[model samples]
Structure formats: structure tokens, C-alpha cells
Target: MTRKFTGLLLLLCFACSLRLAAQAPVQTLLWKKQLQARLDSLQRANGFPGATFAAVLPGGEVITIATGIADSVTMSPMRPGHRMLSGSNGKTLFVASALLLAEQGLFNLDDSIELYIGRESWFTRIPNAHSLTMRMLLNHTSGIEEYLEQGDFMQQLKGHPGHTWKPTELLAYIYDRPPLFEAGKGFSYADANYILFSYIVEKISGQQMYDLIRRDVIKRYGLKATEPSTKQTYKGLAVGYARKGGPFPVAGAMVHKNKLILNPQFEWAGGGFVSNTADLAAWAKAYYEFKAISPALRVQMREGVAANTGKNHLYGLGMQIRPGGEAGMSYGHSGWFPGYLTDAAYFPDLDVALAIQFNTDNFRLLKRAPEAYLLDMARILATQVNNH
Candidate 1:
């Protein structure tokens, strides 16, 4: 009787294990299918030629999804490895590097701009330039006007495609202009802050901003696809598109115009990095896992900074923080450029991070799509991995 009982127990245990094993891959496959379906729907509806997505679970399980074409003109299908412009999303990388320096005690976060980069006289030709600080620059609270909004700036860009821009020259274009508000008084989305912050990164690190980012952040995290914009031509990079008559071009148009090919020197260190979904996912994982920076500093980076009441989307060191429900919150940054839109988010409680990018420039389409899709996909993927 004892022998018979032992055999039956072993059989039962084996069956249970088999059942669990069978269920695991099925769940993963189902999530992947659903994600693919969602991507397809978005592409058809929004006229985007291509989109890429990646997610990482706390346990380190990874899934990457690519749909549509990398270049619609070439009819090249989007690949997992193709690089795309990150635009403002690049700021997150800069912020991460800054935190690493802060961890080393290079500079205090609250230090004034005058302390590190000299006084307003340095930008004496530009009005109110001295009131800016390192913190304000990081948080977009600096009063410095944005160069991109200047009427002549865009014209100059189109006319002088190969023009190499100096940081001071870019700032000079907006010099003497009134700030969006007094320094540290309000939050306004200005690229000027990052342009200045890039200079500070160079001044403090004694390394060019691009090289510093590559060494301190990208290589440190083992990111394979992240590279400085200076290294590649935008035309050869992953194409960005908008709808035919819509706000953004369709993926096909992006490939046709070679919008991806351009020199991003003017925006270097501010919004010039290029990467793909997979690398971005890995970056968020390293960042939130505290592998890239100290845990203490990570907390500070995620913390919210005070800003305009109407613009409650307060800025952090190098990120934007939006308050969530009672349980916890999400953290990440969003980027938009001529032909690309990207956003990434990490849920601390869930231990999951998701990165999504579309090869389109249309803000209107983005407004139509729920930002929650990224979070929703992350949640679905995380739940599946956990259950397994």
C-alpha cells in the first residue's frame, strides 16, 4: 500500500508541474498576439508607417514587437534593431548621466547656473540669461526662450541643412527675449533648458555631452542601439512619417522624404540621440532598477518639482511626473520631434517598464490615442510573467 501511494503522489506532482509549464508559454503568446493586434490597429487608423514596442518585467523577461516598415519607400519592414530619433526622450538619458555625476558629488542639484557656468554676463548679450540655474534648466523652469519657436530658426534650418550650431549661438538667437516666466516660477516646455544643461554636463564632466552619455549611461546599461545623433545620418535612420493629409505623415511619406536623414547637431545633447524600442526598454529597466545610478538619487530623480498650477505636469530633474491614483504612480518621459513620438513609463510597484515609439510627427494623432496604452500593455505583460 505504501509503494502504491508513493507512485500515485509522484504522478500527481508531475501532472501539476506539466500543467503549470503548459500554461506559461500560452499566456506569453496570448499577450504578444494582443499587442501585435493593437499595433496593427493603430498603424492603420493613424497612417503611421511603422511602430516599435518593448517591455521588460521585474524578473528580466523581455518582449519586443515591431510592426510596419522601417522605411516605407524601400518597403523595408521594421526590425527590432533599427534606430529612430528619440527627440525630447533623449533628455531622460541626459538626466540619468547627470544623476550619476551627482552621485559622485561633482555638483549639488540646487547650485545656481552662475556658480557652474559663470554669471549672466557670460550670456550678457542675452537678456535674463543669468537668472537661469542648473535645476531650472533641467526642469524647464528657465526663462530662456526656445530657439525653435523663432521664425528665422526654422527657415535657417531648412536653408542651412549642414549648419553646425554652437550652444552660445543657439542661445544668442533667443537672447534678450523675455522668459516664459521668471526663473523657477513656472513650468514651460522649452528646449532651451536642455540646450543649456548640455553645456553644463560638458563643463562639469570634462567630457563632451555625447561621449559622456555614451560612456556613463548607454554603455553602462549595456544598451546596444543607443547612439549619439552625430554618428549617423537621419535619412538612413528609421523613417518618421505622418498621414497623407493628416497632421503627421504616414510611414510611407517619411521614407519618401528621407525625413530621418538630417544633422541634429543643433539639438545635440538636448534631443539628438537615436535608439530603438529594445534599447529604450533596457534603459528604463536599468534606470528604475538602480543599476545606472544610486537608489537614493533615483528617488530624487523621480520626485516631483513645484511648477505652475495650471500646468500640473510638474518637472523633475530630467523627467516629467504626473500624479496617479491612490496606490502608486508611474514615471517616465515623452518625446516629440518632426517625425517621431516616443514615451516610456515604469511602475515601481509592478516592477515593469514599457517603451513605445511611432514613426510619425503628428501630435493630433497622439492626442487621439490614449497614453494609457503603454501602461496597459506593461500591466498585461507583467501579470502574465508573474502568473507564470
Candidate 2:
């Protein structure tokens, strides 16, 4: 409490602050190099065709690293800016857009989906159509079975890889099917719910879901590298790879003439967007920080039931929350298309975001899931930030 002691303490604190500020740049460079080396080793050891990783620090610094070959045949190197299918991460947009519309007093989340699409003749055929609410679809509690799990659907998709399917066409596979559970009852992770939700979004807004998402989510957040996967080809898109024996059977490069071998348009609302790691990381940060939506709605998005998808995992609205011990509570989404796999997470406790994308889906060749790689990468970054 003495004046002399207080003055000495203040001087020491100022000196420490100056030292830390001077060391920040050196620490940033070292961490980036370390992250790049780690990614390179992971890709080589795991047989991934290529990988891109991005991280956003608490201080707003962005780090991105790319490794391995982008195109197997052409031998092109993967760049940090190369884009790939983000898979189900697209659901984040669907959920966020719906929330924005709801925030604008356009519609209620608890409203029956039938209120929007009831007039369509085929809507009545959908399981639990009359009782399904928009909230059920957002949280995957609609009880609709997954059309992707149907054998005939996959066979048909394999038969015509180049076909651009309509939403109704995709719904036919699950039409008149038994409900997994009554609407708003037990939880079931089904893309069909989002597909139906997409219809609701369009009917309620009188605009395409893609356009709304681009305007409100992508452009609004300055995610310049993110775009809808409606098109078959995109500039700076990395060529994806998969095993020969899978349902797709596209052994080598999954892209031909810069176009996806399979038309991914059917993924429309189910989850369909392509983005690079930097953009994905930025999106994750903006979203989790509640910049994309109101904090109240974001809290509702995190209010999820136990998701049986993984140990200690929960699926809320369109966001996935998983425990990340030292990294703090993690919230985000994982994406899996035929040839690409992605994982993006934002750690609220640390105020950091990280995204990882692989241009290959050969899980057999890898030792762990994409999210595992993401958490480990996050751990490394967290150490750097914490030390500083």
C-alpha cells in the first residue's frame, strides 16, 4: 500500500507490457511456421491429397497454411486460397438466415412449416408435414428420415453423376416414408429437415435461399471467398479425391475440365457451399462472436439436445457444440461431401477461430477425424496466444 512500492510495481508492469508488445510479431511468425510444418507432416503421414488450415487470433490476426498437391494428375500445388466444398457447414447459413428473417419479424420459428409450403400438392406427402415446425427443421428434430441413407437414392445418384437435381426430386426418395419420430419429439440428424426448411425459407421470403444467404451471411460478413455450390466449376477450387470402391467410385481426381464430376446442386439447402480456409475461419469467428446474428438468437442456436453423432457432442439449430477441454468450449460445424471434408470451430473462451479442410475423404487413410485435427491445431494456436 506504500507509494514507493506502488510506483515500482507500476514501472515493472509497464516494462513487461512493452516487452510483450515487442515479442508479439516474433511469436506470430513462429506460430505460423509451426502450424505450416504441422500441416505438412499431417498430410504426408495421413495420405491426404491436400489440406488447408486457417486460424483467427484474439488480436484479429489471420493465419492460413496449405499443403500437399491440389490436383493429383496435374501435380498442382495446393494454395491457402484454394476453395473446396464445405459440405454440411452450409447448414450454418440456413439456420442463420432463418434466424435473421425471424429477427426481422418475418416469421416465427415455432410456426408450422406447412404454413409456408402447404399449398404444394406434394407437401402433404412429406412425413409429419402438417405438424413439422420451422424450429424442428432447424434443430433436426423434425423426425424425417434421411433421404441420403436410402439405397435407391445413392444408386440413382451414382448412375447420373452429372445430373442437377431439383429439391422435389431429392424429396421423392423420402416421400411417404415413415417418420423416425413424431414432429418435435426425439432427435434425428437428417438433411431432409434442412431441405424442407429451405422450402420454408423460400416460400416465406419469396427469394432463393442461396441469394438470401449470400446477401445476409457472406457479403454481410465480408466473406469474399465463399460462394454457393450451385455451379459445377469454380475458380481456384482444388481437385478432390476419393477411393474407388466407395459409392461415388471416382478414384482419382473428382473434377474433370474444372467441373465437379457429380452435380452438387441437389445439396442446395441440405448443405452446399464452397470456401477456402481463411474465409471459413473468418465466418466462424463472426458467427460465434454474434456478429452474424443477435446474441439472444445465437444463444438459442446453442441450446441443443444431446447429439448422438459423437461423444459429448450436441447439435443446436445448425451449430454443433463439442467439448474441447484445454481449448475451451468449441462451437461450429463439420462438413463431408463425397471428396472433401471440412471442420470449422470457434472457441469462445479463447476468442479464437480455426478451420481445416481436406481435398480428400478417404477416411481409412487417416487416423482421426477432421475435427480432431482442428482441435489439435487449435491447441497449438491457443498455446501461442496464451503465452503472449
Candidate 3:
């Protein structure tokens, strides 16, 4: 070979390697900057204290960003590890736990709630109780009413601030309410379903809800910062914030009212877990990889039910399904509570997952903004991953 030809070939190889190396970090940085810009814009537009987000690619790459204060009062900055209430997102965890138990042959998905909890005279007194089942509860097809909508339940609790509720007592509050529709006929989101599921976990596993989740789910994934809400502030925790004038804290409440607050005990299992973005990302990866549950159960978790009209929102055992368009589809659940909002999604085709948590009650803005921005960011990240 001629020296000049050899030199040209070597130059081509060097340029190619440099080009490849430069592309990924450049794209990653650009994606990060874009997410930061969106977060800033949302905070400014909505007057929220701040927001935090964390994401992990299928290949195990991760990015975490905390923009804004966790609490306007103390001027604490939001950090990746700052724990926030996961609200209904806890349902995903419960569902996974239920499936894990099912895989162990403890119970079947189609088993009627009556088989476990039994048809007590008190339960039968409630309308439509006969149709309730474990699957119905997990899939939100049980026709149970949400406890949060009970007349002045919050007011009653605020009046008795020191009272701690047993799961049965909390269940009693909603058991008498009229069903939204026939069991297995519709998908009306209800906390009562998960509250019952938590009880079932205790009944079957003979273990408390917190202990089961810690041993079966959180510990298995090595999730260091995840815990059931204590309804009291802990050291090194992020303070929750409501929108400037939101219904949270309601009127005439005391003791941890009107601030970034959570009643972890009351909302146990249904919506009272607290976790940071990093732990969330790790959990999502573990969930999608079938490390938390069996592969068959994982498939069941991602399958959509036809509880509501038009096939519902593609809900599986615990996770929410986002159907793909041109960008392909993703699956996972999002959460909201008095002072926090979170989203964690995994794209199967791309093998990537992203989680975001904002410690603000600006649900109006949060509902619309973060999902759109994060999905766009995911696309960009996927491009970077594929190019390399």
C-alpha cells in the first residue's frame, strides 16, 4: 500500500472515532439543558417553588436534576435524594407485590375478595359488595368509592388530629357509598381499591403492609430512600408545597396543615409512599427488567384492561400503559398528592426509563408540563443512545 493511501485511511478512522465520542455527551448535555429550561419556565409561569427530575436509560445511564427549592419557607434546595410523597403511584408497588405473591401460589388474580376477607355482615350491608374481587381491586374495577371524596372526612380527621386509623376503620368510611358502576364494568380511579388490596396483602402474607413492601419490593431493588409516609417531617426531608391557594390543608385544619404536608398513615398503601428520584429510577428499571416480579406477571402488569369504555387508559396489574405513536410506546405510572407530583416511565423498545418528581401542588401546570417535556427529553436521549 502507498504511504499516502495508508495515511488517508488512518485519518478517516481517527475522525470517525472522535465524531462518535463527541456526539453522545453533546446530545446528553443538550437534553439536560432543555429539561432545565422547561422546568424553569414552568416554575416561573405557575409560581411554583421548584421541581426535581431523575431518569435512567436501559443501558443503566442516569441523569438527575433538581431545580427550585423544596420549601419556600426554609429556602431548602430540591435535591435528587429528597423524599416526596408518591400518592397513587404507590398502587404500582402494591400491584407488583400482589403479583409476586400470586407467583408464589398464595392466590390467584381472579380470586374473589370474599374468599380472603370473607363476606362479613358489615361488608354485605354495603351495596355491590358481592362483585368485588382481588383483580377488580387491583385493576380499579371493584366499583368501590374513593375515601377522599367522603363528606368532610378530612374535616373530621382534622378535628381529631391525633387519631390513628386502622385499615378496616378507614375502609368502613367508604364501604357504604354507592358504586360508581357495576363491578368489572368501568374504570373510575378509587383509593378504596388499593386500601383493600393492602389489607389483602396483610391477610394473605400475614405481614404488615410496610414490612411486606420493604422485604418483597424495596429491599430487593436496593432502594435506599423509599419508605411509607410517616405523616410527620423527618430530618433531611423535602418540604411539600401547595399551589398559592389550593384546597389542600382544606379550611380549619391544624398540625402540619398548609405546607408541604402528608398524612402518611391515613393514606397507607393507596397513596402514602415517599421516595426520591434516584430510588424511583432504580425501581422502574428493576420493575421493567422483571427483577421485582416474574416475567409472566410482568407481562400481566403491562397488559391493558377493558374496565372502562374504549379500553380504559391501558392499565395493567399496576403500571399505566402509554401507547406508542411514531416514537414508540412506554409504560409506568405517575403520581400526585397535596404537595408533590411524580412520573416514572420505561420505554421497552428503547430500553430506557425516566422518573421526575416536583415538590409543588401546582397540579394544573404539573399535569400538563412535565410529561410533555420529559417525553421529548427521552426521545433525544434515545437518539443519543442509538447513535452510539
Candidate 4:
């Protein structure tokens, strides 16, 4: 190109750069205020014991906000940093550990889990355990019966509120049941699948699921407030409540504002962790942004297995995906335990991530406080981000 033509091109590029630089500050301030207002409005409108929400912008700015009572008895207010039960969301942490092990040549995703934790036949049995693979467990395609759904599971928990369960003990309930489907024939969300994952990782890594999460996910990502929910107590933990007629496992407790605490033993790797909204939001940003995950493993995590619901919603190795969206897709998970319900997601097209936690599960009894509330929040956030 001629010198005169090159000089004009440079001037055009400089002008475009100046325009974008000038608009950046205005966009940042506008988004900060808008996101805060939206969260504040949600807190005011939603009725719950405690609520917290956190979000991260593409530029790495983090914001967390909270509202409502942390302790009804103590009348303590909730804070953004207060930790609460993560429930099944902890599955992702263990999945990451397993993936790390896979990278180190410790195990293969396609390896049969029976090669690791064969049924403790003297203790418990799984009819289809021999055919299940590490990938099946990670993707919830193992056909394992959900121990949590057993008729008497809550009764046993109520009878022994503080009983810490051995993995075998938890499996005992499902031992005699037939497989729900042939291994990988279908998908069902089963806590048993992840519980077995904890065993699978431990058997090979020689480390407990909690320790693996601490080393691979929490400490690695600087999730200061995140922790394995293998215990009932935390310094800044909040009280959890259940809706009226809800099945809460607390002994001699009435539904609706009745306190519920998770027995961490049975929870194991399935839903056995706790964290604040801030930590969860950080997770959305870090995990999806490929901070510590390898590109190959990231591909495995991204590929979806069609869920029983439909192709619109898919379940991947450790994450949930809604493949249909106008400008982007949603990938993350929602968690529900006795007293806590949480949802966190990231929208790649919009370059935003968010997490919302409510310290109560109001399913069945009321449509007003359904678990889908967080999903609605996600739609709202995504729309706003994508519009401009």
C-alpha cells in the first residue's frame, strides 16, 4: 500500500480506539448501578429468611449484595459473605478434581468405576455398578437409584439427626433396587451417582473428596469463604428454613421456618459443600472463563448430554446447559437442600456471571417461592446484558 493510504488507515484506527476508550467508563458505571438496583429490588420483593446475590463483570469487577434475616432467633442480619449450604453444587468441584486426576494420567474418563470401587458386596450392592464408568457418574447417566428419594430416607435422618453416614451405609438403601435404566441408556439426576464419584476419586487419588475440593478448587480459585459442607457448623453460617408441609429432616420440627441442617456424611461429594454468594459468583467467573481448567477438559465439560427433559436443557459432565438462547447459552447449576436453594450461571455472549442464594426451599407448598425464581433472575440478567 502507498504511504498516504497507510497513514489514513492509522488515523482511522486511532479514532476508533479513542471512541471505545471514552465509552468504557460510562458503560462500567452504568452497569454497576443497574446491577445493584436490580439486586436490591429482588431482596425487597422476595420473602425468605436470608438472601444474597453476587455478580462479576467481564472486566473482573465483583459485587455482592444481601438482604433479610440470617438468624430468626438472634435477629442477625444476613451479609454477602455469610456461608450457606451449597448442596449439589459441590458436585462440580469433585468433577473438577476427577478431571485433574485424568490429566495427570491417574485415571481415564471412560474407565469402568468397578475398576475402582467395586460394590462392597459384603456391605452394599449395586446391580449395575460393574457397567458404570467414571463419565457416567459425572454426567448422571449411571442408572444408580437416588438414595435421597427413598421412602424412609428422611425418617432415618430424623431418627438419627447427627448420624454421619459411611458411603456404604448410604448405598445400603439402594442396594436391593433394580437399576433405573441400563448404564448410559438414559439420564436421571441421582445423588447416588455423585456419592459414588466421591468414592471413585478417593479410591484412585487416595484423598477424600473434601480434601480434593480444598486443594483443586477452593484454594486454587481463592474461594476464601467456600468449604466442604461436611459439618453442621460454620462461624458465619445462617439459619435455614423449609416451607410448610415440606419434608425437613430435623427432629421434632414443624414445617415453615422450622430449622434444617444437612448431615454432611451422607451428602459426601454429591451436594456436600457450603459457600457464600460471593464465592459462587467467583466460581461462575473463574470456572467458565477457563482460569484453571485445561482446554481439553473444558471441551468435555462443554459437550452436553441431552437431559430427560429435552434438548433445550442438557446436562454435561458437571454442569447444566440451556442450549437455546437468543445471543448466548446458559451453563451452570442450581442446588436445593432442605433449607437452602442456590443458582449460579454465566452468559458468555454477555460476558457476565451471577449467583443468587436463598436460605429456604419452598417447593410444592407454594408457587410464590418456587426454585425457578433464580432462573427467572438469570433470564432478567441475561436480557439486560445482551440488549446493549
Q: What TM-score would each prediction reach against the true structure?
A: 0.84, 0.92, 0.85, 0.84
- At residue 307, give the lDDT of candidate 4: 87
Clashing residue pairs, candidate 3? Answer: 58-351, 240-260
Per-model C-alpha lDDT, please? 0.70, 0.85, 0.71, 0.73
Q: Candidate 2 — worst ten consecutive residues by lDDT sum?
A: 243-252
lDDT digits (tens) for residues 107-157 of candidate 3: 988887778777565767444677777887887877778887677777766
lDDT of 4 by residue, 47-165 (tens): 55668878776667676777787777778898888777877777777777778778888998899877777645632367487788889988888788888777688888878876888
**Candidate number with greatest TM-score:** 2
- Weakest 10 consecutive residues of candidate 3 by summed lDDT: 251-260
The alpha-carbon root-mean-square deviation between model 3 and the true structure, to one decimal in Å, is: 4.4
Off by over 4 Å in 2: 1-21
- Model 3 residue 145 lDDT? 81
Query: Model 2, residue 185: what's the lDDT?
Result: 82
